[model samples]
Target chain A: MTNIKKLISKPLFLPIFCMILVMAVNIIFDAINGNFALNFFTISVRNGILYGRLIDVLNRGSEIAILAIGMTLVVSCSAGTDISVGSVMSLAASFCCMLLAGFGVSSTSSYNVPLFVGVIAGILLAGVCGAFNGALVAFLNVQPMVATLILFSAARAIGLLLCNNLIVYVRVDSFGVFGGHLGILPTPIIIAAVCILVATVLLKKTALGLYVQSVGINRKASRIAGVRSERIIFICYIICGLCAGIAGIIASSRITSADSNNIGLNFELDAILAVALGGNSLGGGKFRLAGSIIGAYTIQAITTTLYALGVSTEQAPVYKAIIVIIIVAIQAPPVKAFFARRQAKKAALKGGVA
Target chain B: MKSLKKINGNTLLLLITIALFVVMYIAGCVVYSTKGFTHLQTFLNILINNAGLLCVTCGMTCVMLTGGIDISVGSLIAMDCMFIAVGIEKWNMNPILLMVLVLVIGAVFGMVQGFCVGYLKIQPFIVTMAGMFFGRGMTAVICTEQVSVSSSELFVKIAQTKIELPFGAYTNNKGVLQVPYVRIPVVIALVVLIIVFLMLKYTKFGRSLYAVGGSEQSAVMMGLDVAKTKLKAYVLSSVLCSIGGICFCLNTMSGSVQQATGLEMDAISSAVIGGTLLTGGVGNVIGSFFGVLINGTISTLVKTNGKLLSSWSNIAVAALLCFFIILQSVFAKIKEKSK
Candidate 1:
C-alpha cells in the first residue's frame, strides 16, 4: 500500500494516468459498438508498416512530440511559452522547399541542390530566428511572449515572400523519405524518437538539466551561483528552434509541399498544450521530459478518439476544449488542496475512532 | 531640456508612438500624393475601416493594464458575427435582441475565464486559450456555411446607415462633389473609446487594475482585492469585445467561421505599439486608437502601392512592433539607470 501510494504521488503519475484515461475512452466506445473491448490496442502490420488507431496517433503526433521536447526545455528554463513555433515551422518548411525547388520554380521533379543542404539550411534559419527571440528575452529583458510575438506574426509573411507568394513543391521521391516510412516504421516517428532521445541524453548526461532547473527556480540566485542563466535560456531557445525546424521539414515532406498558410497552423498552441498537459507548471521550474512526451501523444490520442467516434473535424475543437478544461481543473492547485484537506480530515477521524 | 528630462517613462513612450504615427502618416502622404492620400477623407476612411479594431483595442488596453491578456476576442468576435447573422437571417429574431444576447454571452464567457484564472489560479493564457478554442468550435457548430445579412431589411438598414461628414467633401475626377462618410460602427467605436478612457482615468475599479497589475503583492498589502479586479478587467474586456464584434458584423454584413481569425493579435499588437506595456500599469485608449490608425495606414499604403504583395503589410507591422518593443526596453533601462 505504501509503495502504491508512493507511485501515485510521483510527478509523472498524473500525466501517465491522464493519458491512460483518455485512451480508456476507446474501450468503452468499442464495447458499446459490440466490438472487442481491446480493439484499440490491436495493431496489425500492413505491407511492412504498422497499422492501427494507436499507430495513427503516433504517426500523426510526431511534429507535436518533437516540438514538446524543445517546449519542455524552454518552459523549464525561461518560464515562458514560445507562441511562434507554428509560424517558424511554416517558415522553415517554406525555406527548405524554396531552396530545393530553386527559388521561383513553384514545382519541380528534382532537387535544385543536395537534399541535406536544403534541410540543414531550413533548420539553421529557424535557429537564427530563435536566436533573435532569445536575444530579446534574455539580454534585452523583453517578455518571452512579447518577444516571440514578433516572429509569430512575421515568420509566415516572411515565408510567403521567400516562396514568392506561392506554395513551393518538391516532387522528388527522395524528398518524401523524411516524412515517409523507414524500414516498416514511419519516418516522422523515428525523427521524433531520435529528437526525444537526443534531448534526453543531452539533459541527463550533462549538468544542463540541473542548470536549467536552477535558473528557472531563481535566476538571480543561480546567477550568483556561477550559472550563466542567460546563456542557458538562449541555448534552450535555439534547441526549440531546431526542433521546430525538424518538425517543419517532416510536415512539408508529408504533404510534399511547403504550404505557407496551412503548414503547422495552430501547432504552437498544441505544443504549448502538450507541455501544460504534461503536468509541468507554466511558471517554470523542475520538469519531467517523459511526462511531456506522454502528454503530446495523449493529445493526438484525443484527436484520434474524437475522429473514430465520428466527430466532424469542425466540431472536434469544442470537445477538445472541454477535455482540456476537465484535465487542467483536476490538476489545479485549489482542487488538489481541497482533496488533500478532505483526505486529512478523514484520516484524523478514522484515527480518533480507532 | 530640463522639463523633457522630468517627463517620465510612460509619457515618453506615448509621445514616441504619437510622433511615429505622425511621421508615418506624413511619409504616406508624400509618397502616395497621386493616390489622394492627402485627402482628409482618406484619414477618415482609415477610422471607418478599423472601427471594430479600435473598439477591440480599447478592450485589450483595459485587460493589458491589469497585466492580463484575453486572446479569445478574435474567436468570440467570429462567434458573435455568426450568431448575429443566423439570428437575423435564419431565425428572424430582432437584431437588437440578438445584439443584447451576444453581450450577455460575452459577459458569461469572460466571467468563466476570470473565475478560472483568478479564483482557481490557472494561468490566464491557458484559460483564455481554451476559451479561444471553445469560441471557434461553437462558431463552426452554429453554422458551417457563409451566412450573410442580405435579406434582413432592418439589419441592412443598420449596416448601410451613413454618417456623412459635413466637411471633407472633394470634387472627384467625374466633376461631382463627393462627400466622405462613415458607417454607424465608427461612431459607436469612438463613443466606446471615450467611455473607456474616462472609466480608466476616473473610476475606482480602474485605479485598482493599475494597482494590481503594478504589483500583486503590493496590491494585496494595500487591502485591494486582486482577484476581483482581474475578474472585472476580464469582464469589461469581453463586454467591449462583443460590442466590437457588433461593429465588425456591421462592417462585413456576413458571418463565416473564419471571420476575425487573427484580430486578437492585431489588438494586442496595437496596444503594445501604442506604448501600452505588456507587463501592465501604463496605457490609454487614445494611444491604442492611434495604434489602430497606424496599422490601418500601413495596409492602405501597401494597397496604394498595388505592386507589393499583401504580406508586406504584416512584415511592416511586425517590424514596427519590434521597434516599439526595443524602444520601450531602452526607456526602461534608462529609467532604471536614473533611479
Candidate 2:
C-alpha cells in the first residue's frame, strides 16, 4: 500500500494519468459505436509493418516528440519558450530540399548534392540560427520571445527566397527512406525513439541537467556556484535548433518536398503544448523527459481520435481548444489548491466524528 | 538642463524610434527621388494602407504595457471578418448591427481570457493560444468558403468613401488632376490612436496598468487591484482589435479563414519596435503608430522598386526589428551602469 501511494505521488504521475485519460476517451468512443472497447488498443500487421490507431499516434507524433526533448531543455534553462522552432523547421526543410534539387530548379529526379550532405547542411544552418538567437538571449539579455521573433518571421521568408519561391520536390526514392519504413517499422518512429533515448541518456549521465535546472531556478546563485549559466542556456538553444532540423528533415522527406509556406505551420505551439501537458511548469526548473514524450503522443492521440470520430480537419481546432482548456484548468494552481483544501476539510471532519 | 535629466528609459526609447523613422523616410525619399517618394501623398498612403494594423498595434501596445500578450488578435480578426461577411451576405443582417455584435463578442472573448489569466493565474500565452485556436476553428465552422461583401450596399459605400486631402494635388501625364486622399478607416485609426495616447497619459486605470506591469508585488503593495487592472487591459485590447477587424474587413471586402493570418505577429513586432518592452511597463501609442508606418513604408518601397520580390520587405522588417531590440538592450545596459 505504501509503495502504491509513493508511486501515485510521484511527480510524473499526473502526466501519465492525463495521457491514459486522453486515450481512454477513444475507448469510450469505440464502445459507444458498438465496437469493441479495446478497439483503439488493437494492433495488426500489414505489409510486414505494424498498423493500428496506437501506431498511427506514435508515427504521426514523431516530429513533436523529437521537438519536445529540446523544448524541455530550453524551457528549463531559459525560463522562456522559443517561438521560432516552427519557422526553423520550415527553413531547414527548405534548405535541405533546395540543395537536393539545385537552385532555380523546382523539381528533380536526381540529386544535385548527396542526400547526407544536404541533410547535414540543413541541420547546421538551423544550428547557426540557434546560435544567433542564443547570443541575443544569453549574452545580450534580450527576451527569448523577442529575440526569436526575428527568426519566426524571417526564416520562412528566407526559405522562400532559397527555394526561389517554389516548392522544391525531390522525387528520389532514397530521400523517402527517413519518412518511410525500415524493416516493418516507420523510420520516423525509430528516429524519434533514438533522439529521445540520446537526450535521456545525456541528461541522466551528466551534470548538465542539474546545471540547467539550477540556472532556471536561480541564475545568479548558479553563476556564483561556478556554473556558466549563459553557456548552458546557449547550448540548450543549439540543441533545440538541431532537434528542429531533424524533425524538419523527416517532415519534408515524408512529402518528398519542401512546401515552405505550410510545412510545420503552428508546430511550435504543439511543441510548447507538449511540454505543458507533460506537467512541467512553464515558469521553468525541474522536468522529466518521459512525461513530455507522453504528452506529445497524447496530442497525436487526440488528433487521431477526433479524426476517427469524423470531425473535419477545419473543425478539429475547436475541439482541441475545448480539451486543452479542460486539461489546463484542472492543472491550474487555484483548482489544485481548492481540491487540496476540500480534502483537508474532509479529513478533519472524519477525525472529529471518529 | 533640469528637463534633460528627466529623460528616462521609456522616453529615450521613444525618441530613438522617432529618429529611426525620420531617417528611414528621408533615405527612402533620397533613393527614390524620381519615383515621387517625396510626395506628401506617399506618406498618406502608408497611413492609408496600414490603418487596420495601426489599430491592432494600439491594442497590442496596451496589452504589452500590462505585461501580457494576445496572439488571438489575429485569429479574432478572422472570426470578426467572417461573422460580418456571413451576417450581411447569408443572414442579410444590417452592417452597423453586425459590427456591434462583433464588438460584443470581442468583449466576451476578452473577458473569458482575462478571467483565466488574471483570476486563475494561468499563463497569458497558453490562454491566448487556446483562444487563437478556438477563434480560428469557429471561423471555419461559420463558413469554410470565402464570402466577399460585394452585394452589401452599405459596406460597399463605406469602403469606397475617401476623404481627399486639400494639398498634395498634382497633374498627371494625361492632364488630369490627382488629389491625394485617405479612406474613412484611416480617420478612424488616427482617432483611436489619439484616444489611446490620451488615456495612457492621463487615466488612472492606465497608470495602474503600468504599475502592475512594472511589478505585480509592488502594485499589490500600492493597494492597486492587479487582477482587475489586467482584466480591464485585456478587455480594452480585444475591443480595439475588433474595431481593427472592421477596418481590415473594409479593406479586404471579403471574409475567409485565412483573413488576417499572422497579423498578431505584426502587431506585436510593431509594439516592440515602437518602444514597448515585452517585459512590460514602458510604451507610447504615438511610438507604435510610427512603428506601423515604418513597416508600411518598407513594403511600399519594395513595391515601388518593381524589381525586388515582395519577400524582401519581410526580411527588411525582421532586420529592423533586430536592430531596434539591440539598440534597446544597449540603452538598458547604459542606464544600469549609470544607476
Give me the runs in candidate 2 sitting further than 4 Å from their true place: A1-8, A34-37, B1-6
Which structure among the candidates has the greatest TM-score?
A: 1
Alpha-carbon lDDT, every model: 0.89, 0.89
Per-model clash counts, in order, read: 0, 0
> Per-residue lDDT for B1-339 in model 2, tens only?
999989877788788878888998999999998898988889988987789899999988988998899989999999999999999999999999999999999999999988888888787877888888889989999999999998789999999998998887998668989999999889999999999999999999888989999899999999998888899988888899999999999988889998887788788878888999887888888889888988888899999999887788888888888987888788788878988
Local distance difference test, candidate 2:
0.89
Candidate 1 CAPRI category: medium
Q: What DockQ does each candidate score versus the true complex, computed on alpha carbons?
A: 0.69, 0.66
B1-339: candidate 1 lDDT, tens digit per residue: 999778788888788788888999999999999999998888988998899999889989988888888888999999999999998989999999999999999999899988888777777777787888889989989998999998788889999998888987989888999899888999999999999889989999978888888888999999998888888888988999999999999999999999997788789889988889888888888889889988999999999999999899889999998998898888888878988
List residue ranges in candidate 1 displaced over 4 A.
A1-5, A351-354
Candidate 1 chain B: worst-modelled 10 consecutive residues by lDDT = B118-127
